[model samples]
Target: MKRLILGIFSIICMVTANSVQAQDKGPEFSKLDVSPMDLAIYRNDKDQPVVRVIYSRPQKRDREVFGKLVPYGKVWRTGANEATEITFYQDMKIADETVKAGTYTLYTIPEEKEWTVILNKKTNTWGAYEYSEKEDIVRIKVPVRKAPNNIEALSMAFEKANNGADLLIGWDDRYVKVPFKTAK
Candidate 1:
């Protein structure tokens, strides 16, 4: 009787220890200098709060500028390595409408006429190569503009303002412009 009880106890202890060991042996993360989304809020002249979305990545040259080799009127992953992603901590309006606070995938349609920026429900996709139309959350049409100097690389930035921000996308001597403002 005592021997049986001791055997069961030992088995339980060994199983618990093995489970812990397995968990500890899971994937290890290294120091990765990865780009992340930058979101912020500020006030406008009327003291109204505004929201902003900033997407940044390491700049690379010799790569194909979007809309040319990347093509126009198609979904773009919006980033180099990973599908572009954005997070909004607070409720904000884009293009004079309201959107909830959440994480979203960002896509773009590059065209000679104008560019379309899309906010999608799905998050964390590899690139536009695997983009699915069903995952799109919202689409906003933004205008395209030419840059003064040649960029030769793809980059995006959001400049905070009193009421909103300027969504500036630049690549290879061209640029696209967009503005996001909070709805009342």
Candidate 2:
């Protein structure tokens, strides 16, 4: 009985040690790019655009190619490891409505006609595999556009526009745009 107890305790210690090592590994940041994209949405508030989405993403692996592998219509986690989260410095309007500023998980519903961008209440989750609709904070539909060239890798870019800049998501060389307006 004494030997059996000692063996079980040793196994438990080994298992715990392995789990601690795995947690310390975190996510493989070296294998991924952490490019930051800056976004600005102008509001009539005249306080400079209070709404900004600091976005970033990793390049797609050959097997994880967008559209071809991710497919046209599906729920995308929007980023790697932890869900793609947005930090709102202040409140902003979506389709002329109000959304308080804070960190939020961004999910998307991609379709040929229009793309639905969801601000989910859930944060720090792996891919959309465990996504729950109950965690949605907001859902806004946006238009999709065809790219002139093929983008083999997934990318997020913030480009300046005449009115408000675009937070662009490009993959398989295609792109989508979601416009925001400030509440008067």
Candidate 3:
């Protein structure tokens, strides 16, 4: 009877030790994403914040990017993985609409001649799958222009303009500039 009790106690201790070892294996991490996230910011000459954008950059990989991989006349997340997000540090005018200082999801409709840039109130969205026109704060049409050079990765940058700054989105051989008139 003592031998039987000892055997049961030893089995329990072994099982507990095995469980601890399993937990000690650490976490299983996922593979790297093909499209990594990126950021773009525009500031006034006074060093005050004007605007900021967070988005993912998808590679071209020698394939036709626009009107094919990314279809025209459809709302794109403006990047990859998660929908692009834009923040207005100050009250700004997009097109004719006045947008208050806040964060918004940025979506776009790519076309051969023009692109419809949208700023929606929705935040923390994964993709354009949840996009709704009702939540849009502003919609502006920006003309598509030929980029001087090819950009293999989806990229965004701000260039100072007369009114404020132009947020340029470039990929492949095409690019678009969205104008923002900021109070700053």
C-alpha lDDT of all candidate models, in order? 0.69, 0.66, 0.93
Per-residue alpha-carbon lDDT of candidate 1 for residues 1-184, written as tens digits (9 for 90 to 100):
9999999999999999999999899788777545444334444566554443445453544656665667887888765667777666557667755778787777898888688888888776777777777877677887778789877546776667435566677777678766765544
Candidate 3 structure quality by residue, lDDT tens digits, 66-129: 9998999999999999999999998999888889998999999999999999999999998899
Which of the two, 2 or 3, has more lDDT?
A: 3
**What overall lDDT, based on C-alpha atoms, would model 1 receive against the true structure?**
0.69
TM-score of each: 0.65, 0.64, 0.83
- Candidate 2, residues 1-184, lDDT tens digits: the string is 9999999999999999999998898666554345333343333335554444544455554555656565668888665545676655566566655667777777887777678898887776777877899988778888878888877555665555544445677776568876543343
Query: Each candidate: how many clashes?
Result: 1, 1, 0
TM-score of model 1 (CA atoms): 0.65
**Candidate 1 residue pairs in clash (backbone atoms < 3 Å):** 44-162
Candidates sorted by TM-score, descending order? 3, 1, 2
Q: Residue 16, candidate 3: how far off, in angstroms? A: 20
Better model by lDDT, 1 or 2? 1
Error of 1 at 80 (Å): 1.1
Query: Which number leads on lDDT?
Result: 3
